[model samples]
Target chain A: MKQWFLGIGLITVFFSQTVQAEIVFVTLEKDNALAIVDPIAGKLLKTIDIGQRPRGIILSPDYKYLYIATSDDDTVKIFDAETFVEVGQLPSGEDPETFALNPKGDRLYISNEDDNLVTVIDIPNKTEIAQIKVGVEPEGIAVSTDNKWVISASETTNMIHWIDVATNKIVDNTLVDPRPRAANFTADNEQLWVTSEIAGTLMILDVKTRQITKKIRLDIPGVSADKIQPVGVVIDKQRRWGYVAIGPANRVAVINAQTLELEKFLLVGQRVWNLAFSADQKRLYTTNGRSNDISIIDLENHKVTKSIGVGRFPWGIVSKP
Target chain B: MISRFFMNRFLLKIILVLLLGHTALTYAESIQVIKIAYITQEKKIPAALSNLDAFVQQKGLIGAEIAIVDNNTTGQFTQQSYELKKIIVPVSADVVEIFKQQVGEDISLIVSNLPRTQLMSLVNLDLAKEMLFFDATTTDDELRNKQCQDNILHMLPSRAMRADALAQYMMKKSWNKWFLVMGMMPADQAYAKAIKRAAKRFGIKIVAEKQWTHTYDARRTAQSDVPVFTQGVDYDVLVVADEQGLFGEYFEYRSWIPRPVVGTQGLVPTSWHRTHEQWGAVQIQNRFKAKVGRWMGEQDYGAYLAVRAIGEAAVRTKSRQMKMIKDYLLGSDFALQGYKGNPLSFRAWNGQLRQPVLLAAARSLVAVAPVEGFLHPKTELDTLGFDQSESACNNLNKETLPVKPLLKGTYDSENANSYQQIIQQIINKIKQNF
Candidate 1:
């Protein structure tokens, strides 16, 4: 096939550059594989067989292991990041879509979307610690840097469940815009940011007061606001910029971190779902689900520099140091 | 249905825990409960058609109850709960007194599944002025036109919308020539009128038109009647107008000419169907089936949408006041996701909820409309229902007519009064083109 030849040609062209770049892991959702990309060379270095419906991919705080949430198998498989071989497995609940790592680096808060529960796993013991019942279709899990609070955003209930990490119980809940998809705490833990996919608004909550400080509507000149579904978000504290992957709009909205103002809508591949920043935060990699490729963006240039073909329906991404 | 009644109570608690956070258990006792009343007439169905009916004895009442459960599931987290006061009045009974006695002064929102005549009578009562009624049953166009009730918000699609939806799908397939068949019923006659209007609007030609005057006879005479009934018509499709299931189903394989049947027959246009399994509809479907033990019908969906609208308004506004909720419902920002792939809103000119109609066959979904290429300046859904610029419903008061423009932020901040006049002229120009 022409596509196969095109991919091989791209790999050869990419191999001529620096070959010992940081590895970027991308979840090939439909292919049941995890692709390792050499970011500096812009080549897919290798792909390891993951389980069925592998969605969320993240590295441990010490970067020793890679944890992948295999939704269909209902288990988080831990792989040795260097050798790319299976090392361990965590007990994830039914249909785990995503998970968050605590700052202490020994706890995993996993979101079981179908079960409507946030399953907490003790990494050292490799056992389920607690199951905190949340709202319907809980998708996003974010843990505060202090490891005091765990927040889970539900898609159907359209609210963020604030769980006290000490008690493993819901301390409070705050209603956001419709179809809340993802939540993240600011690096300083001063504020909490939540994305409402259907409402197309990024809501910021004051951490101390737990009140909505700002609601920023994402709009591109040519793109309809209805199609601008804000799903994945990653904030770079150093650069003072937050990038939001607008689903189906094929663009990442760059926002000024302090002002919460949308600065630019950088067009990427089709149906961009998730994003990741490199160790130096110099480049951003995005998983274009529909286009079946990963777009590498030079953050300094504020444009997509190159696109490397991945597997079918690439969903989540993470970068190695 | 009877066995599931007790099961629903236990299931609802589990659902509440699953849908609401653990806050529901901690703050269970202190939550504020918003009361909603559901009023429907207890009409008898013909014994012949009873077997085919999907609804249990509760029908629309069950849908309202399911929505109340959902509301409470979300309500617990917000320190708000919901209660349903269901009233099923006997046929030919005084609905106004039943409504007044059941609702009293506590409930401000009423979900009505009554007949058109009963609804009209109830809406005329002095007590109805203070309450907002959600019409979930009737598809009568007059309610959105000549008999438009300011307090009544329609959840079900108008007959015109259904016809237009089918017309759009038919137009997409280039099935321009139609053979119109009508059953001898008053509701069928109104549906035929709607179809005719849709045909004219969508540029379809009615090659032949006929009426089904023959009654359903078990004596084998009905079979002889249909072949002759559908003869001599050379049309691409047969559009049947049968509100009640009198004889629409019999025309599928018995027609003289081999053509597709649409409208209320072989491939029908509806607000909801069992086969519409897209855009998270399956979640609601599974929930409804678990509680009601039957496929969710159109009437059930209508009632579900009505209660969900009230729930959405209450949740969004965080207020139980009737005035605030009413303003929010009629305002621009009040959009409800009715599992129709789009956020459904209301038409300001008339109180009709603008939504996409489902074109479905018996076993699967056929299409959803407003179809591709049917463009609207504002929303594609506006192309299906009566648009504000072209509707005959001029019931909106002139003073408050500018409310929509103000809500949409389309009016010029400077020269507000002059812009109202200019907007009127622009609307009139749009009417001429339609």
Candidate 2:
């Protein structure tokens, strides 16, 4: 009996460690700092500042480094995830707003807003591999799970350019709502969701068919009109729930992922920009620019659990493990 | 213990089956029906209804239903057909308050084809909270200017936009000195005032001003006419503003004027004309004549476009919800398959629908205005109304608004550039130009 109880205790310890793994790095918007946050306690442990206006952050699948698109300085800053220190910086196209890293971490797709071009960066050597011309004012970018296609939203054209990842050429361009600011693929990889800020609506396009399947209108009064802009969007792995950040309203709209029904507004700080979830999926964090704080929401209750002090003008958020 | 576990599993299976069945039943609920209230004159009801009916049928939208309310007849169109609910109250009556009282939660949208004063009454009610109002008539600039409302979607072009188009064309010809001749009527005076405002903006100097009055007396034509006085002024253009058709046609080839005449007569600016053949106008004109069984007029096109805008919004959003449709219409890249060049979109600053103004000579389309160089901060198309930086509305956030610096140069110089070069230069020059 003693031996059996000891074995059970060992298993419990292993399970808890796996569930509560520490966050390896946290990317900052202002100083381009990658702070090593103590994930278990949710505290900022250390900070390493890099390039200018660092945004659109993501971690390599291998958990080696974090890549951030520094828009103002026109470079992509790479930092070692373990040490939270700047490893290298890659030159990107002009006014790089958002980017996507290839599944193998071999190539980076960056959307250049001012230049109307998508720059492909080769990862190992930190060099630009190719530059493909796209429509006017390309802002948001998302890569396919299979690494076959990279889609970027062109704001002025009101369309999404689907580029062939291998050839670095535009394969297809599909019309979407006006001023499509952000885009993300569903977990099942069947549908692409785009948010049009001026249109004040969310457009869902079928990935395989390349056709708009549905356009869901947000009902929040002040948030659905002139300046009521809808910006960031994220879908859960199970495709059960989706969340979108309403820029002017300063709140995140919780939506039923399957039905596309707007559930309710989860109030955050001023000028809510982008959102990301913790690895355990228990907490959701949003970068509120005006408040200069990160709003932490308890996902289960759909309420603001805490507002953590972060860098000035926090614009983008990404979780690292 | 094994049997108990199996029983629990069986119970869970039963509950899951029942839940799925209930969900399917809920999904089978009927689609929401959209109710539209259409208010117009008795004479115009039959034509409007038939056109709308045919359009709805062609579009395959089976859910929308319209209720016509005619104000001219004693009994409304509502009484004649079961689908209609009520008639629009008479103009002399308290129609504004009546509409407010009668507009229930069931009404999704209101289509009004009424006079200017009547339309203004409806606009004053602020019915945007309950229903969306589509104004098919009323060319009053105030409706689109100081009296502009969030809920009101204008179908007709304002007087200022039309006058500005003509003024722009005149400016292109370097016709700076204008002989302004206006009638005694209120609309004529207002139109003349609008013309003078445009002349000032486009650098056209009003060299002389004259007024004509309609009279029943024998010596009226000789006495009321300003031809003798106008001939003495040194002017490059003659502008006549006559609403009652009093002195409009007489000003065309009068002995006094050696230059081109514009405004209400010789070269007038309008929304649509029969001879407009460029940029897919021929197709629209042909289709409209075929559908309506008559030559297309400005009012007819305006009415048709209002409905078409709604249809386009519905098709794009894939829903009939008023709020969604409204947002979609106001969004950038909203192209209307009509007379306007490229696609028509709402100006983000003033909420005015940006469109190419048509200048008509007699019954033929002559030119499109803003005549090139009359530039706004953001777009050349924005030169029609108030610029964003100059707008007096305090509700908007000035920080996010684009500050377009005024483009300088005479209209003649602007008309020199090729179309492609202008488009290319516009795209390149703008900081965020699309």
Candidate 3:
């Protein structure tokens, strides 16, 4: 029985790392276009122009479709991943800024900034099922690994609203910093790390208690507190390291998860926003909006290995095999 | 008869000797020693002084002499102008008295970076006749407005100009519905007001305005508190005027409405950033980082431009004289060479330095100002700050201020310039000024 338990634990760890390493990056450019880049090659393979300000993009769990929220068009455009062709478009809540895909890829939770609502869409049917009202400026959407809960960060309210996936009802809302822009759960789904861009700090919340267990502050004075702005966050499943994008600073901060201490700062390109890692966890790519390029960092070296020029105003990156 | 003859010859010789001595004295007086006094409390001032000294030495200006007095010292150095003395006071007046006392009546020019009040005192000095004051710092509009002095030449960009450039850009985006978020501090209020004025001038509407008491409001982060402020709001963009490090960053992702964020957190207009490599930004960034051992900020870029402006003016006029430099700077064709694009000139209506503003999305350069479509009745440059036709300044000193022909045709008066044009103009101005 002891041998069996040990074998199961080892297999879980191995599979988690494997899944984390083989991720895909779906980036949005300033011109309302999407560029899919392969992490291993450090090259952009396809560029899909979606109409009228495309942002907050996510891929289906099966890696078949890519869904993008177009703010100006007020629709979510779907593309066939392999062929890099548009499949269809569905109406999302107005001004959908960011979103999260369900574990099984059956639903997409979108944070619509203009309407103060979180819209749920059926991935297969390509239709909006329900719209749950939340705090003002809903952004930073994420789904729990178990697919039981959906979380949306309301920037104006400084709160995180948790929704029960099955019932589509508000479960709990917890206060955070001035502007909670991004959030992601730990591998085990025990904790969630949310980035408060305005506060220049990261809030770690207990998944069960829904209370902030730790507030990690960034220390880089001389730059304005506004410049220390934190945006997208990604955590390794083992919870050993957390990578955060400091927007104004245009750098990625690698934090030791256990100690919450900032370990290293890797300089990327201008307006560095989001990240997507390779399947092997050997490479990380960030979209730099201002520089109009993608910064690729070698995870092992913890430095920018190369920068690949992409479309205008690149934001939000995702990687997949 | 022999004694009388010897006495007469001796007297003649003595007279000759006296005449030679008088000639030598006249020659010595002709070679004037231009004495300059430098006053500052900061130790770094001396280091900067050394750089200037090297330049002067290289130029073989042997007749010039510099004397530095630490302003932190007691009144030991206090004195009014003595004969033939020139005083250069750092942004402080405590040392002004010392310069006056040490070099009475001989002061030619007063070089200072002092506040308006301190500068006013020196301007009012009875003994400071023919003394031209070169102001390196003071950005108070009042100095150029009500307190306009013939002797004082302002250098830094006024707050109004900065606000106007940013406002014009926002208006261009058709982002008229402003959610004005200001800090509780007085400076923040002033900045916000400037932005408000610009918005109004450009026909942009301020839909909602709120003052955040950031310090004492610990409950700002409370989930219960979120609904109270943002429950119902209709605004296109959030304009933050927080200079005291208040709620600017805290307002991100916290808005009650779902709209693209702008102003302080979302998209910001600044003078310079490290990632700005557009146009000549890379060269400037590299040179500045090499000199300072760090990346350049807006303030650093502004300071560098101010100094470079003086240099550019000197080169244009082919003289180090202040009047000639001032004239060249006011001339339309006078362009600053380094970081800023094109040549920078002063607005005829106000003495504000006309430069372009940059849109920095954090450390990266999002876009250069004077964005694509902004047109002016005069030149595209007018899109950067207050237009000449609408300017309050009449240029009373136009005779002394040289005017060159406009480089580009005036923008269409009937059609409004695009937001991108306005941004580009601001950016061009920054480059020109820098």
Candidate 4:
């Protein structure tokens, strides 16, 4: 009777896992469009005209609205998550490339790359509340889950700035490797993962003290060291794996989160830029900017199951349940 | 007793506010001032084949100015400030007095827009011992090699780096046969020598080599004359060494075999160009255009890097001393963002800034080198210029104590025209002897 029960449970879990994710949205930089795909069915549902140079994409906490950073337009466009219709706009300062939305979904911090300022916006009011001055060429930005500190990683300055959420001022700074491309905070808010594109290394900083806990040198056999540029970084909430998209190397480094070590390299599309995880975290989606597609990684088996062609130069991705 | 105690408390509060205000004022005044000197000789730029190309009278100085603005912006946050002192002299002027003048004023950092001869003169000046000089203009390889000084750091890529960059792109395309065309200018001859060196290093064959002897303006006549000039060689590409904008532009679409041209013209290899828009370069390019009403050229970009490097080193080390700044810059920890897809650092063997050279056409960037498959154990950038083993310059990492004490001096900018007469006589005598 127990064997029979286990067999039935296996079938149920398989089907449930198949339907874990509903849809995935990818922003195309060159084509200026958003590709909607059904990850379970592995189908490109449709594509809609997005905006000029759509790069950074995020969803509201409730998943009712979609926020896209149209970099060339110098504004972040808001859309109805279900209808895929433009709803509003946020006043992102000049040349917004990447941004972070607070866990509360009330405040949004935009990285004004050229201006070297993090412009904060009240999402509901669609108004600029504060613009915190940071380092030069600030790109990577992340707000802690508790919404206490917002971290801005400056590319040229090689420094990470800690912005207090309550005050919207830079409270502290930590020096990192050259050309830090992205930053990701763990769900528990204990660790922060930063990627250095030029150094080809991933730095894990202790969030409490802002001290770099570990530095993982990203490398792949047969791939030139210069091509192992670490860009987008994401960590599993289960603390199993931390995946970093190695740009131009065309591989996602699957790091062992528990051991805090590099485990394996999962081959992906060309110029793999950003990554997004499904709501249930069953699958991972990576936008390959050069290949113009998204590589879907089945997290359970640590395999790239499929590569779905998107629009031209897919730069950003976000998956929905 | 209560009234007296309240009066004393009010007085104390007033005094406390005044003390706090005084400290703030003093802090503002005490911000570290990093003074820099920009020296450029006003040399005559060769007239372009057409009016399409721009010629800036103030080439590297504008870039330094823009960088000063950039430095001051970062300074506001770092609690530091920057000052630029420019000294523009005529092409024939002796720079010794100005060099002494700059060093006397405690300007330990200097940006040089001078050519090799003028730059070497400054490098040899007795007062230049304790100062750091950034060569922003010249691409002379000799400065990074045989003539290298411990204090001189080059912002411009050597001619060898540019040639190697172009050669790499050509190698990638399988265009191995290069036809070499030489010009008479000393700069052009130096460029050709570097090209020959690159061809040998990369194992590419030079199908034929010819010197550009046509002296007349080829603007209108290039249509008929270029085909004849380029007729014989069945080469994959024409590599011209016209640094003075001579006949290099005429080879485009005018080649006998319809081959493409590369080198100083056509698809040129450069440190920075107006058309380069990758690796977050567009941000700086846009900012430059907004500040100065023209596209930033190679020397301008070089000058910009020089000032920014000083600013960066100052912020990193938090020191105003020249020796400390120089040590930090040459150390392993110094990495600068040059918007070239790599973190630039100076080579300890040669004071040259190791960078990726851009192969660009008129409209867009073709590719960046050291291209794929070119490997170096230390860094791929070492593939471009003189490697540590190949370079003769070794004083970069060693301590260079001040050779002579600086003396205060006042300057006369004029009366240096006779200096050229002496060099002219020497050249004439050498020509007669040869």
What is candidate 4's lDDT per residue for B75-187, written digit by digit as tens? Answer: 76666789999999876767777666555646879999888787888888777787899999888888888878988999989999999998888999999999999898888
lDDT of 3 by residue, B360-417 (tens): 7765666656665665655455565445554555543543345432221232111122
Label model 2 with its docking quality class.
incorrect
**Which candidate tops lDDT?**
4
CAPRI tier for the interface of model 1: incorrect
Candidate 1, residues B19-58: lDDT per residue as tens digits? 3443333333445567788899887755342256553566
lDDT of each: 0.82, 0.66, 0.63, 0.85
| Candidate structures ordered by lDDT, highest first | 4, 1, 2, 3
Q: What is residue A139's positional error in candidate 4, in angstroms?
A: 0.8
Candidates' interface RMSDs, in order? 2.5, 18.4, 22.5, 2.0
- The sequence of per-residue lDDT tens digits that candidate 2 reaches over residues A1-321 is 999999999988986675457563435666566545544455665666766777778878887887877777878778777666678988887767788888788888898765667899988887898998775567889888878889988764567888888788877777676668899988678889898776678888999978788888775753324335678898887888888988767889888988978898888988787888877677777878778777788888888877766666676677765
Of the candidates shown, which would achieve the greatest DockQ relative to the real structure?
4
- Give the TM-score of each candidate: 0.79, 0.46, 0.43, 0.87
**RMSD (Å) of each candidate, 1 decimal:** 13.7, 24.2, 27.3, 12.0
Clash counts per candidate, in order, are 0, 1, 80, 0
Give the candidate number with the greatest TM-score.
4
Give the Cα error of residue B256 in candidate 3, in Å. 50
Worst 10 residues of 4 chain B by lDDT: B406-415
